[model samples]
Target: MIRLEALAKRFPPERQALQGIDLEIENNAWVLISGGSGCGKTTLLHLIMGLDQPSQGKVFLHHQHLGRLSAQARARLRANIGLIFQEPHLLQRRTLWENVAFPLELAGQFGRALRQRALESLEQLGLGARATALPAQLSSTERQLACVARALITGPSLILADEPLERLDPQNAALVTDLLRARHRAGGLTIVQTCSESPATLPDATARYTLCAGRLVPSGLLER
Candidate 1:
């Protein structure tokens, strides 16, 4: 579970990215936050991931204050979180399987086990055959699916996806969305951000909210 209390973020001089955003996501619940570009949706996710510090207020991960933890502690805690970045962020030099297995290798699992887990994740994303291919050999959609495989390989307790369905064909977009929904249904907490909700992704959301000019708009039901 995660909780944010009066969270706010301001960049440099007068620009504000978020203002007093308070939210709670229960374990296994799926929440979607929608906002146009520059509207602070990604800023909110970064704060939650502890990649950026909150300018004010606090962020609690399962009741532990993020700002209160040391760097090493935060790094350890992050292993429990899966994140799909706005950019795929895949290493061009590594093959898809290697890229997906990198995190597990860093966490001390390698060789057969690492390959197996990475392959399983890839297969889940319908990318099994591309495991031996480099990033350059894949299409934009394949690249994104590789990123999703990388994120989910570790079986993280929570998933934070930033505009994950962008840059994909409708079929692929729906595939990825359904994967996330299935993960949530199977008891993994998920939080996704998009410029707007799509029919492919919003149907199973436990809660939904829109953000505008750094503030949360009133909650509304998203058509399934």
Candidate 2:
């Protein structure tokens, strides 16, 4: 489970980015956090991911307090998570398959099995033919899909996606949505995604919340 207790953040010169945000997310649940830009959605995700510290309150993942974890320990903890950034930060010098296999490589998996797994992930994202292509060679949509492929290759139990559908056209956005839904339905995957505007066909979230001016407001359940 993921829990946040009175979470808050402030930037230099007293710019409040988040305030008194309390939330809990159960395992295998899909949660959507929606808001306009500068509403602290990304900041919340960062705190949850242990990429940033909260000025007040605490963040717990699987009952482990993130603030107390040492940097090395936090790095170890993050190995279990799949993070999809708003920008597809692909390695310009690496092939798509190589990029997807990166996490596995970090965990010491190599050889034919690694190659096979990477290719399979790319295939699942409909980028099989572009597996050997460089990030610069692919279109924006393909790069984003490639980022998705990399994130899922590790089969993480929790997925943190920041504006995942932002740059895609409707067709590609639907494709990405369907892929995430399939994984969530397959069981054992908890997805927490942020968006400026929720998609029309977004799957019913286990819970939906909106952030405004650094405060989290429950948006209630979405109807099918």
Identify the leading candidate in terms of TM-score: 2
Candidate 1 residue lDDT tens string, 50-156: 88899998999878999999888887888777888888889999999999998798688868878888889999888999999999999988998998888887878
Residue 70 error, candidate 1, Å: 2.3
Each prediction's TM-score versus the true structure: 0.91, 0.95
- The weakest ten consecutive residues by lDDT in model 1 span 192-201
lDDT (CA) for every model shown? 0.82, 0.90
lDDT of 2 by residue, 1-224 (tens): 89999999999998999999999998988888999988888899999999999999999998999999998998888877898988889999999999999989988899999999999988887889999999999998899999998888999999999999898887888888888998998999999999997555566578788898899898887653
Q: What is candidate 1's TM-score against the reference?
A: 0.91
- Which residue segments of model 2 deviate by more than 4 Å? 222-224
Task: Estimate the lDDT of model 2.
Answer: 0.90
